[model samples]
Target chain A: MSTPATPLTDEELVLERLVALLEHVAADVLEGPVTDTGPGSLRRLGLTSVKLLEFLVAIEDEFGHVWDDDVEESVIGSLDAMAAHISAAGVAPAPTKRD
Target chain B: MHVKGIESWDLAYDGRQALHRTEDGSELYYELRGAGGPVVTLVSTIYVVSTAWRNFTGNLAGDHRLLSYDLRNQGASDGRPAEFAQHTEDLKSLLDDLGIERTYLVGTSISTLICRDFANAHPERVAGLVLVGPPFSPRGSSRRRRIAKSWLAALDAGGPRALFDLIYPLVFGDKAIAEGGSGAYLALRERFLAINSAAQLRANLREALGAGDQVERLTSIEAPTLLLSGDDDFSTTESTLDATAEIMRNAAVEIIRECGHLPYFEQPEAFQDAVARFVASVEEGTFPAPWTAPATEGKDR
Candidate 1:
């Protein structure tokens, strides 16, 4: 059997680190307006593309990596969205969803 | 480019020694950038040096009459302990010095926490206030109280850098520190950090962290207030600071995205955008709901 699935790579580790930092940033500092899950959820957060760029700079600075090089816009847009990108990038730990 | 979208000037508040001096003989040094209506005061957060707000003042300089002062016994000012009353007086004095009648006051961190106290004491003096990144609670923690006590002791001996080194790391995330290390960003850390003495730094820190528990007086603030903050600021912890926001029935909330403790620095453009919108609403003589919290909460790993 293929050697038990190898552990996350260094890039993965870096991506995970980025996600962790992103989560902290989202929860503690730049909390957009609370968004309800619906077609209109995006309108409520009040986060514009400029705000997203700010987040992009933050993630780049924190992980010592540029935006496109490591993180995709899909990942940096929101906490879970960013985490999913990390997972997809083969970096972050699989998220555990709790109801 | 001119910071804050306007011209810049080296404005100093003169104490007896020279600069922005208070009635009690304290001094407040600050940078003035901008020209226009809607006079605004930007109170520096205690944890970081006033320069930490370069991103803030830089953007706000030209549009509105902006005054970002290094609090008394702070930022190239004298080394002395200051009380809430003393700060309120300093602000009033600064405004008077500039011939500004009633101006908007914007405070972050510790300064934001006390906007109400200032408003309560001198309601007629404040036109409007924007309280951003207020303290978690007004009640002093033992550690905080000890730090406050320590500041009284530390103020006289050293300079801003020595004091900043102790406090900066906590508020500044890895980016600022690392970028600073990369020699990629401006290398004014030591210079900006070194401007004040240890005692003066402590005085500011003490005033900020030691200022715990003012929720009782929140209702007294009659000024139109805009509560600006980010959800991810672990230090202030939105829930706790929101209690104060809740106290101000007339207050509105603006929370940015992906910003940490110092969102103004982390995201100046966003900061400007959010505040500009708020200021517009205030000017239009109407207040909107501001930003609302997301209904769906993300789970922690």
Candidate 2:
């Protein structure tokens, strides 16, 4: 059977979903050092670039999108920044990204 | 009392000594016991040494060959000048040196991670796998990030002691620790910590820690797989167990009742039975689920 059309086009949603994913990755996977946070308190998590790719794969699974062409290297730097990327893509950020 | 039918032997691989070296050129140690068909090996994880597999191996070796080795940087293996050397390669080299064509794999702790990678890269070499306790990984329900925050890098700096203290609680469940033999565990621990420098331990950790989402990499492991864990194993949470089983094309998961992380140590009888059942199932060419997608079904396009 042919697939039904998606309401949101693929391009419009990719970046935003990836940002949402990075935030989730930070809390659960990376356990970012900044347990308490503000715009000024971005402490680094231990995830090197290669491990970060694993998180990206999980996000792609959660959103059902192929991260192959959509992921940008800079978009994953921080949870707040990642949230903004996802929010810009129209999905509202959840109250907590820990799960 | 000791396990009733338990056995021990000092057999060698391929009718020869089973000694092999690590990635850093450190000689590793092992004792091969039991004698049945051929199940490739036994590998050490963090704290418990290869000796822990003594009884289980004895029981299963009737028609199978069991190879249990003290991994480099741990147990009787040489731990000097350690660095994150090629662990899978060390295992392969052991097999190659022994002249054994192929056999099943059974490992514990994070040894499963190493075995999983080896199984992926050399699918042809692995007949089946029985991994116990699982290990630390980001894929779990919730990871304990706080306790050993600098643990890995510390091991890289100091040695096994850098994380062995924290790891003890993670490896042995609460009851086992309180069973009132603190000296036994500490002595065992000191022996492990004394050999390697912290930096070498760190290198071992970096190399042995779980590969990210091995669930995906494990997709390529077509061998029948068996996973054994305890209900209260802190190292392997429910989510991690479920995620692993979901991804493997052929696999089965068993939770040992009233047991801790060291199922082989905590409940050797049950562990033995579980192994017997899984191996029998493997010989029959079926599992609770296939370890990979049915090759008969074409690609998932």
Give DockQ for candidates 1 onward, in order: 0.02, 0.01
Question: Residue B82: error of model 1 in Å?
Answer: 3.5
Ten-residue stretch with the least lDDT total in model 2 chain B:
B3-12
Per-residue alpha-carbon lDDT of model 1 for A4-57, expressed as tens digits?
888975554654554454445445434543334333232223333223334444
TM-score of decoy 2: 0.60
Q: Give each model's clash number.
A: 52, 18
> What's each prediction's TM-score?
0.60, 0.60
Q: Which candidate number has the best lDDT? A: 2
Off by over 4 Å in 1: A1-99, B1-18, B47-54, B138-166, B173-189, B209-212, B290-301
Local distance difference test, each candidate? 0.55, 0.58
B175 Cα displacement, candidate 1 (Å): 5.7
Q: What's the C-alpha lDDT at position B260 in model 1?
A: 56
Residue B139 error, candidate 2, Å: 3.8
